[model samples]
Every structure is written in structure tokens, then in C-alpha cells.
Target chain A: MNLFLDALAWIVAPERFEGSSSLFVRLGEHLYFTAFSVLIATVIAVPIGYLIGHTGRGRELAVGLSGAARALPSFGLILLLVLVMGVTNKPAAAFTAFVVLAIPSILAGAYAGFEAIERRTINAARAVGMTEWQILWRVEVPLGLPLLIGGIRSAALQVVATATLAAYIGLGGLGYYIFRGLPLGRYDEMLGASILVAVLAIVIDAALALCQRLFVPRGVAAGRTPSLRTAPARRRAMVETSTAP
Target chain B: MNWVLDNLDLIGRLSLEHLRLSITPILAGLLIAIPLGWLAHRYRLARGALLTSAGLLYTIPSLALFVIIPPILGISYLSELNVTIALTLFVIAIMARSVADALDSVDGNVRQSAVAVGYGALRRFFTVDLPLAGPVILSGLRVAAASTVSLVTVGILIGVESLGYLFTNGYQRRIVEEIFSGVVMVMLVALLIDLALVALGRLAMPWARRPGRAAR
Candidate 1:
């Protein structure tokens, strides 16, 4: 422990931590890489996932594809990209992170959203002169909004964490601070990075929880609230029914 | 074909190392997480803290965690113990969540009935709750095990030689065969571990063998 503390002290002592500008720039770049990848992935995944879920035409294929996408290790995929893209962060880190992080949430969200809708509800929409597209836009999508948002929230957090790998390929994120701290025996800098990552994750999670509350059906949120003693019973019923044949 | 024939021994060694590295941490993680999760299930406050902590841990990048740990612990990459700690952190968080969720999913009436009976808290938990929660916990373990196997590959970046070392080595030398071999080997190992977990789940939780009956 003493050695670790000594290492941390050594890393931060030179500057007396006066250089906030460089730290901010590095932080910005890291956030940029993470946010951009997640944004791009969300754009591509949500619509396609929604389409598959609503149509039920290619749901199996979409689910299988997403599973396969997830099974591929992120590091292995990044290395594969680095081989072809030459590792300059543009096509390498961003695209790889997008693929790894996007598919699962998108598919899970879409499936949950679609599944959450009562079959009778869809039939009701269709019987009332609603076009298939209109039903999707007006009925199914809104109902699934909570699950969809939850998926995106999970994916976004995951991407931010994984994006730190970009430092290895010379893309320069907060991971650079971490790796630099490691070799230089700088425990403080390393701790700083870890703390920053943890804070970012918690903040993002809290924000998403707020978003989920805002968008989820009122009944669902009410069922989850502490004041509702019957919430657990309802939650159990929901889980059982969803898993039931 | 020549490359395969020449490097068979090295490949075998790497495969063994891969299993050793992956399985040790997962088993250790399950051991710690299941108990911790059970504790959380017994206590409401513990449940909230454990779940939130698990979520936070899940969101931290595995690579960054690995890098950050060595400095804090004053450890070297060469130490197997250090790598185990890194991998265990990832596994514990996921497994804890799974265990807690599984226990929570058990029928409330069953728990109340157990309490009404002569069975003590520990006995009730062991005989009734754990048995009922087995499938959900195992499923979570399966996910954790699979993810751990893949993440173990990242340990190579910090100088620990698992299958990931093969890809890094191959990339440096521009040897496509080595990279391909690494990727294939890791995938195969991952699949095998996943299958083993599924089989174990079936044996441990007979309820899971019957569709539509097991708790999610």
C-alpha cells in the first residue's frame, strides 16, 4: 500500500496538478469518442430493431445476429479492425466500439417493447383503419419507449467504458492517463482515472433512470415505487407471465 | 498445415493456459458473489447497495480496471494473482446481481410459508430459496462465465499471456495465421465454457429442465 501511494505521489508531484487544461482536453476527446460511437450505433440499431420487432418478420434473424455480434470479443474485434483500418481511431476505435456496444441493447429493447404490447392492442389498432406503419408509429413504439430507453441507457454506459480501449491504439482517451499512470508508478493518476470512470458511469445511470421514469408507462413506474406494497406482487406476476408459455 | 504441425505443442500450451486463466477466476467469483448476493437478499439495504454497485462495476471498462489495479495494489502484470483479482472484480459484480435478482424472483408466499414452519432462516434459505433460485442464478453465471472468458483475453495487453497474447504477437509480426489461430481458439473455448455452464445448470437445477416452469 505504501509503495502504491508513493507511486501515485511521484506521478502527480511534478506538476503539483496545476495543468487542468491538458486534463480537460484529454477528457473531452475521451467523451467525444464515446458519445459519437454510441450516437452512431443508436441511430443504426434502434430503427432496425424497431422494424424487426414490429413486423415480426425477421425477429429471429435479428436476435440471432445481435447475439453473434455480442459473442465476438471486443478486443478481438478491435484488433481485427486495427489490421484493416491501420489504427488511427476513425474507423478503428469508433466503429469497433459501436458494433460491440450497440446491437444487444437495440435488440433487447426492441424485443421487450414489442413483446410488452398486448396482442389485442395491435389488433385493435389494425381494426380501426390504422395502417401497419401508423400502428407502429402511434401505438407499438410509444408503448415500448421505456424498455427502448433502458436498452439505450445500458448500451451508452457500456460504450463509454469500452471506449477507453482507444488509448491503446493511440486515440488518446482517459485510458491514456490510466496506462501512463501505470508505467510511471503514478497511483494518483490511475485512481483519478478510475474514479472519473466510476463517476461517469453512475451519473449516466442516474440520468437514464430519470429518463426511464419519465417515459415508462405511469402504471409501471407506480408499480415500482416504494409506497406501493403491491408492486412486488405485480412485478412477480409480470415476470411469470412473460416467462410463461 | 505445416504451421499447425510445427506449432501443435505451443497451441496446446496456450489452450491449457487459456482454460486455467478463465476458469479459476470464474469459480472464485461465483464463490464470493453468491454469498454476498444472498446476504443482500436477506437485508433490504444491502440489496440496494449491492445492485447499484454491481451496475457501476459492470459499466467500468475491463481494460481500464486492469490498468488501474496494478498501480493501486503495487502489483506486477507477471503475477497470476493480480490478473485473478482483476477478472474477479468483473465477475463478482455480474454474479451478485444475478443471485440477488434470482432470490428476489422466488415466490413470496413460499418464503412466508418457510418462515411459518420450524425451519430457521439459514435452513430455509438453503433448502428452499437457493433451490428455487438455482436456475436464474445459473443463467446469470453462464453469462458471467462467457463474458469473463472473453475479457480474460484482454489481460494479454498488460503482459499476461493468455490467448490474447497470440493476437497481439501475430499483429506485431503481421502473421495472419497466428491471429486467426488466437481468434478461433478463444471462440472455441468460450463456446465450450458456455456449454459446460448450461449443462451444469441443468444438473444443479432440475426445475430448469422443464420448460415454462423455471423462474426467469
Candidate 2:
């Protein structure tokens, strides 16, 4: 406890506090890396996932690959990149995170969204002479938008949190504070870093949740709300009906 | 092949250490979280708050959580305790959500019938809800356990001795074989845990025998 207090005091001391400006700079760098990676991943993943999910060929392979990507340990992957890329932020942090973070949500979203669309609607669009791209843009993407957004939300949160581990490769971020503080027995610095990371995750997740609500079409939202609200009651009714006879 | 031959003993020791560090804490976390989740389900208003809190904990970066603990609790290799805490925080949220969802998925008639038959709330829960909900809860545990295997490796970055220690060491020292050994060990541990959990799920909840019948 004394060590913790002392660490806190050290962090607050004006002289020590002066060095803290770097913490903010590091945070900005971290966010920049994460944001770019997520953006790139979204662009690649969404389109690829849509194509596969719509085409219905090699979909199992695509989805399985994405799941595999997600399952691979970030620490191990990051370390592997360090070996190949030699510790620069661009390849080590930004590029790797893009590949690791983007695949699962994008694929799942596209697959779920495309699969959810009614077959007759697609047939009508095609029957009316819509091009394949037209059917995709006019029919699939719009309808799938809600689920796609859900995927992006998850991908964004994951990328932001995992990006902190970039500190291991000497790219500065809030993780730098945590990693540097740990070896030196600086508890307050670690606490501050942890709190900041946690808060950032919550803020990002909440913001994404709001975005999902905003971007999801009103019709879909309306459709889902009634079902969600009545699910329990429906189950209860089913129970009663089943037992009655 | 040459690399494996040279470091077989070291790899074996590291693998054993990683398994030791990961297994117990996750089991403990699952044990605690499932009951809390059940409680949350019983009380309607508490469910959202409980899940949200757990979700919040889930977001904290594993490395950041590790660094934060030593300062507060004081650091040691026994930092196993801290890793356990951090792992627990994540597992609780996951397990709780899964448990609540599973309970909700149970045939409502089962519960209503049990109630009508004069089975008390506790008895109904034990005999009906728990059995029906078991598969979903186990699925959650499987996910938590698999992830915990990976997360426990983060403990190494903070100075705990495990397979992750080998990975980090290999990176720092530029020993490719050691890195391979560490990576392979962690993956094997994760796979084994997943298989074990699946087997347990099958044995404990016969309903899980049919895939997709339980909550995916």
C-alpha cells in the first residue's frame, strides 16, 4: 500500500508530471494506429465478406479463416511480426492489427446480413434486370447494413484494446506507461494507464453501440424490437400451450 | 526437427508451467460467475447492470490490467493471483451472460409446470432450469477457458514464468526455436482445453450432443 501511495505521489509531483505529456502523445499515436487499421480492415473485410456471403461458394472457408484469425493469440502474432518487420510501427502495429482485428466481425456481419435477406427479394431485383453489382448495392448491402455495422463495432473495440500491446515492440502508447511502470515498481502509473485503457474501451464500445442504433434502418429496428420484446412472453405461451394438451 | 530435438526438455517444462498457471484460475472464475449469473437472471432488474459491469471489465487490456495490479498488490511471480483476478473479471462477464441467456432459453413451460407442481423456486431451479441451462453455461465456460489459456500468456509479459515467458524471451534474444516452442505450447494448451471442455459439456449435459440445439 505504501508503495502504491508513493508511486501515486511520484506521478503527481510537478516535476514528474511534466514527463506525462508524452503519455498523451503516445495515446494519440495509439488511437491513430488503431483507427487506421480498423478502417482498412473494414474496407477489405466488408467487401470480401459480402462477395463470399452472397455468392455462397467457399463461404465456409472464408468464415473459418476469419475465425482462425481471431483465435490466433495477438501476443504471438505481434511477436511474429516483430521478427519479420523488425519493430517499426507501420508494419508492426498498424498493418498487423488490421489483419488480426478486421476479419472476424466483417465476415460474420456480411454472412449474417446477406443470409438474412429474403431470396425472393434478390430474385425480383435480378428479374427486373439489375446487374450483379446493382443487386449487391441496391439489395444486399443496404439490408445487410445493420449486421455489418455490428461487426464493425466489435472489430473497433477489439482493435483499440489489443493495440496497447504494441508497446512491447517499443511503439509508444498507454501500454508504455503500464509496461515501463511495472518493472520500476510504479503502481500509480500502471493504475492510471489501466484506467485510461478501460475508459477508452468503454467509450469506444458505447459510441459504436450508438452508431449501430443510428445506422440500423428504422424498418429493421422496428421489426426486431417487437420480436425482442415478445420473446419471453412467446416462450411462456408456448410452455403453457405445450403442457395444456 | 533439429530445434525440437535440442530443446525438448525445456519445451516440456514450459508447457507444463503454462497449463498450471492457466487452468485453476479459469475454473475458479467459471465456478463463481455461473452462480452470479443465475442470481442475476432471477432478479430481472439486476441483469443489465451486472452484464454491463462484466462487459466493462472485459474491455480492459490484459497487459494493462497486469501492470496495474503489481503496484496495488505488490509484485511477485505469485503474480499468478493478479492474473487470476484479471482473468476472473473477464470470465465472469462472459459466463454470466451465457448463463442468463441459457436460463432464459429454457422451455418456460418446464418452469411453470414445476412451479404448479409445488416445487419451490430452489428446487425448480436445480431440477429444471439448471439442467436445461447447463449446455449454454458450459458453452460459455468453453469459450472462457480457451481464451483464458491465451490470456494467461499475457502474464509472462509482466514477468510470470509460463510458455509466454519463453515466447517473450525468444523475441528478445532472437531465438527462433524458443519462439516456435512457446507458440506451439500455447496453441496446444488452448486446443486441449477446448477439447476437454467440449467433452465435459457432452458428459455433463447430454442435450449438447446435438450441435446447434444448444446456444451457439
Candidate 3:
């Protein structure tokens, strides 16, 4: 409790907010690493996920690959990359870890989003003369936006949280405080940084959840009258798995 | 290759330690998550709050949770207990949601029939609902196992010994082969656990594996 109070006080102290290594500066650097990695991951993963989801090819392989990718330990990967690549360019090593960590969630999100759409609705769009590309962009992408955003949400939180490991490799981020504080016994600083990280994750997830709710097509959101075979369990499973990182 | 061969004994010991650290927490987590999951599923009022809290807990970074646990629990920062407790918390947070979802996936009519047949609540849960929810719960377990295996590598950063000791030591010595071996070992462990769990899931849920059954 004392540590918590000290952390709260440290967070509000004006002196703590303005220096070169101020909490705000570390926070900025942390967000930079997170946002940059997520951007690159989004660029790489979203397209691959989109292609696979749209064509329905390689779905099994992609799922297996993403699972393997997710299973890679972030800490181990960072250290391995840094060791292999040499410590001269630490950001490259750190970013690679972050990017790898971010990819599986985003990829899962993107493809799962596409898969969540009703096949009948997609066929109806095609029947109306939409080309493959048109159907993809016009029909699938819009409806899948919610899941896409949800995936990004998961990826962003993952990157933000995992980016703390970057400090281990001497890269600047909020993790630096915790790493430095541990050896120095600076509990307030360590706890304060952790609080920031937890709050950042929660705030980001909440925002994305809101985005998911808003982006879901109203017709789909407000389901049709229940038939005898609602398949409610299956539908719930789809939503649950798709949204999970 | 020569270095890896020479270090085989050390690797074997570390691997055993890693397994001990990773597997214990997962088993403990399963025991804790099932009841929590049951509570979340059984009560309408508790469902939202339970799920939300679990979800929130899942969002905490693994490293952060690891560091935070010592202070909260009043354990030594370097204690293996810190890693075990944190990983257990992680497994519970993740598995609880999966468990609740799995229980929800059990057919309503099947549960109704069990009730209709005069089985007591506990008997029905064990004999019917649990077996039916087995596949999904097992899938969640696979994830938890793989994740825990991978995460045990992080224990090295905090001065705890595991496979990650190789990575940290290798980094300090600038020994590329040592780091490579560590990474490879962790991946192998993760893959093995994932495959084993998949096989176990298949064996436990024979009906789910049949053709024309639900495609998991």
C-alpha cells in the first residue's frame, strides 16, 4: 500500500514529468516502439490474412503458422535476435521481436474477421455482379472491419505490453524504469511504470471493443428472428475465437 | 554442434527444470480455473463481472505480472515461486474464459436430458457437461501449456535459472551457438507440448474426431 501510494505520488509529481528521462518521455518511447511494430505487423499480417480469408486457401496452414509464431517466447526471441544480429543495432532486434509478437494476433483477427461473414450474404453480393476484387473490398472488408479492429486491438495491447522487454536489450521504453528500479530498489518507479502499462492496455482494449461494437453491421448486430436451429453456440464460438489474440 | 554436444548434460538438466516450472503451474491453473469457470457459467449476475475480470487480468503483460507478484505476495524477487505463481495466474485468466465458453458450448438439450433423467447436479456436471466440454477445455489447455513453456524462458531475466539461463549467459559471453541452442530447445519443448495436447484432446473426445461431427 505504501508502494502504491508512492507510485501514485510519483506519477503526479511535476518534477518527474519534464526531464529527458521523464515518465512522459519513456511513455512516448514506449508508444513509439509499440505503434511502429504494430504498423509493420499490420502491413505484413493483414494482407496475408485478408488473402487467405478471402480465397479460403491455406487456412489450415496459416492457422498452424500463426500458432507457432505466437508460441515463440518474446524474451527468448529478442535475446536470440540480438545475439545473432549483434548488439550494434539493438532497435532492429527489438522491433523484430515486437513484430513477430504482434503478427499472430493481427493475422488471426484479419482472417477470422473475413471468415465470420455469412457465406450466403457473400454469394448474394456476387450474384449482383460484383467481381472478385469488388466483392472482397465492397462486401467482405466492410463487414469484417470490426474483427480487423479487434485484431489490431489485441496486437496493440500485446505490443505495448511486450515492448517492455525491449529494455532488456538496452532500448529505451517504460521497461527501462522497471529494469533499472529493480537493481536500484526503486519500488515506486517500477510500480509506477507497471501501472502505466496496465492502464495503457486496458484503455486500448476498451477503445477497440467500442470500435468493434460500432463497426459491426447493424443487420448482423441485431440478429433476425430465431429459427428452430439457431446454432447460437457455434455463432458465439466464432465471435469468441476470432476476437481472442 | 560440438558445443551443443558437450553441453548436453547441462541442457538436459535445464530442460527438466523448465518442464517442472512450466507444467506445475498449468496443472494448478486448470484446477483453479474450472471452478471459477463453473461459477461464471452458473450464475447470470456473476457472468459479466467474472469474464471481465479474467479478461482484464489477461491483458497484464507477462513480464509485468512476474515482477509485480513478488511485491504483492511478499516473496523473494528471485524465487521460482514468483514465476510459478504468476504463470498460474496467467493460466487461470486465460483458461477460465475458455472454460466458461466451453461449458457454454455443451448442448442445452443434452444438459436438459441429464436433468430429466434424475441425475443430481454434481453428478450431471461430472458425467455429462464436463465430458461434453472436454474438447474446448483441452484446446485451451494446449495453449496454456505451450505459452507456459515459452514463458519459462523469461525466468532467466530475473536471475532464476531455466532454459533462458543459456540465452542470458550466451549473450553475456557473446556465444551465438549457446543462444541458438536455447531458442531451439524452447521451441522444441513448446512444439512437443502442443502436439501432445492435441493427441490427448483427440483421444478424450473421440466423437469430435469423427467425420461429419463438428469441425473444430
Best model per DockQ: 3
Candidates' lDDT values, in order?
0.73, 0.73, 0.82
Query: What lDDT score goes with residue A162 in model 2?
Result: 69
Higher-scoring candidate on TM-score, 1 or 3: 3
- Report iRMS values in order: 5.1, 4.8, 6.5
Over 4 Å off, model 2:
A1-21, A87-94, A116-135, A224-245, B69-78, B211-216
Candidate 1 on B25-88: residue-level lDDT in tens? 8999998998889877767788889888877777777766775576567777456777789889
User: Taking the tens digit of each residue's C-alpha lDDT, what string does model 1 give over A163-215?
Assistant: 66656555666777766765676656666676666666678778887898798
TM-score for chain B of each model, two decimals:
0.91, 0.90, 0.93
Which parts of model 1 are misplaced by more than 4 Å? A1-21, A87-94, A120-130, A182-188, A217-245, B1-6, B70-78, B112-118, B211-216
The parts of candidate 3 lying over 4 Å away from their true place are A224-245, B211-216
Residue pairs with colliding backbones in model 2 are none
How high is the TM-score of chain A in each model?
0.79, 0.81, 0.87
Task: Report model 1's chain A TM-score.
Answer: 0.79
| lDDT tens digits by residue: candidate 3, B1-216 | 888999999998998888788888989999999999998887756778988998888888877776667777888777889999989988998899889988888877677677678989899989998888888898888888888888888778677799999888888888888888888888888887777777877777777797775434
TM-score of 2: 0.86
Candidate 2: tens digits of C-alpha lDDT, residues B1-216: 666788889888978888887788778787888788887777666787888887777767777667555555565524677787777777786788888888877776777778888899779888888988887787678777767787777888766777888768878886667766677778788778777878877787776687555334
RMSD of 2: 3.9
